[model samples]
Target: MVAGRNVLRALRDIRSFRVVVLHPADAESDELVAQIRRIGCRVELIWPPRDGIPDSTDIAFLLFRQDALTDAILRSLEDRPLAVTLIAIVEAESPTVIEAVVRSGASAVITKPIRAFGLLTSMVLAHKFSTGKLISAEKMSRLQTRLSGARVLEQAKAIVMSQRGVTEPEAYALIRERAMANRSSIEAICASIVSTGDVPGR
Candidate 1:
């Protein structure tokens, strides 16, 4: 019962999503749009491939044709800061097609003939995968920033030790005191100390 409620809630939430279909007008594209609309998502269809996704797009279904591939389509696949989930549509399982799908960074794939059977599953999984990737990226960025601040803090401590002939603990204390006095972060004080080669308000 709980799982069913969660599934229903998820479906309801998907109604607010804005989906973009980057495929030429045809039976397949029409079917895709119809199915997505039936699922209660707002759908927009575009052809000939634009250089970028629209700012309002929350999810995008991109058709990849081996022979019809263009620079504009590839540019559209380039990394953007938007939280858009990408689904690749392909007609073949050839190596070239697989390569294109990989390059597009699609989290899920829909094969030709566009059946409604797996469409919702693909959308849900792709969105979950994209959201996970974003969370992981944000965590990595935070870790990197902390590592950078550690390096700067250590460098600042070393400079203080050399300049004042104090021990490491004393140097750290000095830095904390300076940070508090300036109403700033220890990392900010450390950064300024390292960059200017002198402690502030000394």
Candidate 2:
């Protein structure tokens, strides 16, 4: 599935990537921006991030390592509605910071010092996904699986909350109830419910 997803993604249009390089330089900002422009795909140069994200810059990169993202930066990008943040970091960053970034909805991380090819590839792949390219049988299958799982989890949790008097998040209780009743593992029970629409005592 992963291979087929990559194959479909690889066939997408690479030209659609629009990158925003943030945390700008003073006198050097325009110079670096000019150099980035010469690299020849759409690139936006911004600082302070307060004026709001330019509409075309779908993928944003923090060219330097920030221990934690500032609320201002988050606010600026959030205004874009569909913007995806790309963070660049070295390999030794603390897992906590990485977790924060992921939890905050970052799309991907690029480890620096970056190769031009790898950067370009990441940009193209992100843009393709952002542009709604679900190009392979495997990707389609995986997407269906994800949607099915989400639906099943929601319904199962609702069932548990209704019948057993538990909170909506008792994923464990929902699984346990379905599993014990059906004589199956929680994983298998959830999979059955998701894929085959089976629910015990419904």
Candidate 3:
């Protein structure tokens, strides 16, 4: 539930995207590009560039085997941090190709001979994947904070028991009482006690 609320909100907020399509100009790819434009996205089409990197944008669609272009765009994506999601356009599925796609930071893929039916679905999946990754990172950070707080609480309880010769439960009760009186979290009060090496309100 913690990750759910944020992920759903992100999905709802994605209205229109500025999409970059990197593929050799062809009838099928062209038609797919046109459909994306009709959905109200600002679309840019480029046949892999020779020497320059693509500028950062909301999303990018990469055609496999365009090594130079994919590298350039991935470089740009890295510089921009979590600001872009890549969708790979591939002709067939294989272990090597799928590994390369993910390693390049692609969140989703569209199999080639592009079908209009699944194009939109792929875009949605990419956005969802990106949001899920962010949610996971946030959860990990909170978990780390809790772990650190637990260490602080343990140290504080030890100090209480040693200084007052009380049982562990008694020491914990003392810490909880102090926390309530000071209108702070048990972890915060414990941190103060641990740092000073003394139990307060003795």
- Judged by lDDT against the true structure, how good is candidate 1? 0.87
- Per-residue lDDT for 20 in model 2? 73
Error of 2 at 95 (Å): 3.6
Residue 77 alpha-carbon offset, candidate 1, angstroms: 2.3
| Highest-TM-score candidate | 1
- Candidate 2 local lDDT, 12-88, one digit each (tens): 43345566777556544454445445555577776656666677665676643344345456545554655454544
How far is 178's C-alpha from truth in model 3 (Å)? Answer: 4.4
Q: Name the regions of candidate 2 deviating beyond 4 angstroms.
A: 1-12, 26-39, 63-69, 83-92, 131-202
Candidate order (TM-score) = 1, 3, 2
Better candidate number, 1 or 3, judged by TM-score: 1
lDDT of 3 by residue, 96-136 (tens): 66767877778888886888887776777797887678788
Q: Please give the range of 10 consecutive residues that has the lowest summed lDDT in model 3.
A: 48-57
Using lDDT as the measure, the top candidate is 1
* lDDT by residue for model 1 (19-89), tens: 99988899989999999999889999988655567877889998877775534576656866547999999
**Residue 132 of model 2: what lDDT?**
61
Better of 2 and 3 by lDDT: 3
Which regions of candidate 3 fall more than 4 Å away from where they truly are?
1-15, 22-32, 44-58, 64-69, 75-84, 91-97, 113-115, 177-184, 195-202
- Give the range of the ten consecutive residues with the poorest summed lDDT in model 2: 83-92
lDDT score for candidate 3 against the true structure = 0.77
CA-only RMSD, every prediction: 1.7, 11.7, 5.8
